[model samples]
Target: MNERSPVRICILALPETSASVVYGMYDMFMSAGRDWGLIVEGTPGRAPIAPLVVSRHGGAFIAGNNVRITADAPLDACDDADVVCVPELLVPPGEPLAGRFDDEIACLRRCHAKGKILATACSGAILLAEAGLLDGLDATTHWAYCDFMSRQYPSIRVRAHRALVASGDGERLIMAGGGTSWLDLALYLIARLAGIETAMQTARINLVDWHDVGQQPFARLARTRQAEDAVIARCQSWIAEHYAQPSPVGAMMQMSGLPERSFKRRFQQATGMSPLAYVHTLRLEEAKQMLETDRQPIEAIANEVGYEDAGFFSRLFRRKVSLTPAQYRRRFGAMRDAIGCISETR
Candidate 1:
């Protein structure tokens, strides 16, 4: 908060957690405000982040990959910290984390209740999901785990292709997708807690880059899940669930509480789509899911996704999705059936 008082960041360490992520985050956080100024201007700047590692107990232990770690404090000692971050954990996707982290999960709940900003990188999100903290909140993890996460926690809107996601009330729950996107998460946290200038300086000093293009390309999927703007992010999440409602764009504009022109501009900037286009994308995505999994009539699917006229919906589907509604269903629906059969045989 001040020059002398840095943002206290507590990193949770577990036996299954990777040491590289833990220490990589530690090094970057330690250099937040202090490195760039000294490197360029030859004057030391105030350190913006003070990182502390905490484990289940109050001592040293070996991590999953045989790396020894010493904790600065136990989980109970984290009350003084401003934010608690969970680096990647090496748990298997779809594996239940039922009894492994009772103490760690409780600590997170307590910290979140006290309004401490809670964050996770990669499969560390599983711990947050295990804590029931992500209930009814949009979230993401490594792409491979997206389906497992959705299946395990149905209340969570799993954004598989999003490299980063900020959800929950006040957007206090932050998560990053697989790999080095944790650097982006750290920079974003510094920007949120300290200042954007310091975050930029940290990036410049560390030679780290933001993953602006997101993980969809990596996951071999596509779409815009951009949400750098907090207000626009909230509106986007709102419209995701309510896309089937009448006049959804107007509803999002109202939810954003911005002037018509301002809301339109910000929405476009935040997502690469106009307000109407954004709503249409969401509706079409839902229609695709329904078509793949259900045998409902095309008219029914169209109407359910907020399109009243079946003919108009068919035209738009072809124009935007490059396939007729029936054609899209026949292709992907068969794929789904084949996948189901394959799974059954296996």
Candidate 2:
């Protein structure tokens, strides 16, 4: 995108959307063309973007924070946006969206059909999925909603571990995961549409960290639910206690009092994982915790998590976590210490 013309950014404002996201997006885009050079030097630069908040109704709408905000224009009236951004939507945890926000979905479909670049933050990706825009495309949302989106819309490939994912034709679809990631989306959109120098300038002015590790570190791994199966529930509870025991799957099978064939079938149906796979996951989770918090040696941590060989555990950790145990400790341990320092000061 050239800087010759101002890029029009239309931020969709809905009743369920986060108020901070809408305002922050507008501020970031508007500051990009002007704030960077002023912060670096004394130069006043020309604004490169024209951002406007558009709503279904032209009247004032209340956001998640109970703040009332009036839109710059209605969605129907604003049909010439170069980029359309869908901010984080307020929804209850683990609630199925069902028939909610159908009108917004339709409007987004229209925007995409008009060749406008589409972007989503947090649960807003649900709107894109509902609009049939993400079908057969690789998309991501907040890690919490990843499984829900994948189960609801089976055709779309969900990358739960990515902080941001760009897919589809010409990579028109941009998605950022969970809360506060809309800021990352803003910086990226500026860089893509404006220039890297412009994005860096904006970052410097705002004191924002531009690079973020993907969603893997923040993901909730113990999210497995036993689907109303008593046998599987019992097995899971037993595994929780004896995950470090040798032959955990065998012990679970015997404790379940079900035949091997029936046990495997029921386990898969309830947990969506094989019995052995579940055991390995439990061990890995325990190892991850030890790596993050404790100062134990890697070999001792491996033994605690039921792995006799440290080399094998290290390989497995790298494969699943994209970081070695030592590396994970070095990064997250320092982060935890920094947070502790802030807490102490407070």
- Candidate that scores best on lDDT: 1
Off by over 4 Å in 1: 220-346
| Number of colliding residue pairs in each model | 0, 0
Give per-residue CA lDDT, model 2, range 19-72, as digits (tens): 888999999999997975676677879888889999987669788889987898
Poorest lDDT segment (10 consecutive residues) of candidate 2: 218-227
At residue 125, candidate 1 shows an lDDT of 95
Candidate lDDT scores, in order, read: 0.86, 0.84
Tell me the TM-score of model 1.
0.64
- Whole-model alpha-carbon lDDT for candidate 2: 0.84
What is candidate 1's lDDT per residue for 12-125, written digit by digit as tens?
Answer: 988898888998899989898888878889997888789999988869999978999888888887788889999888977656778878999999999999999999998899
My TM-score estimates for the predictions, one after another, are 0.64, 0.88
- Highest-scoring model, TM-score: 2
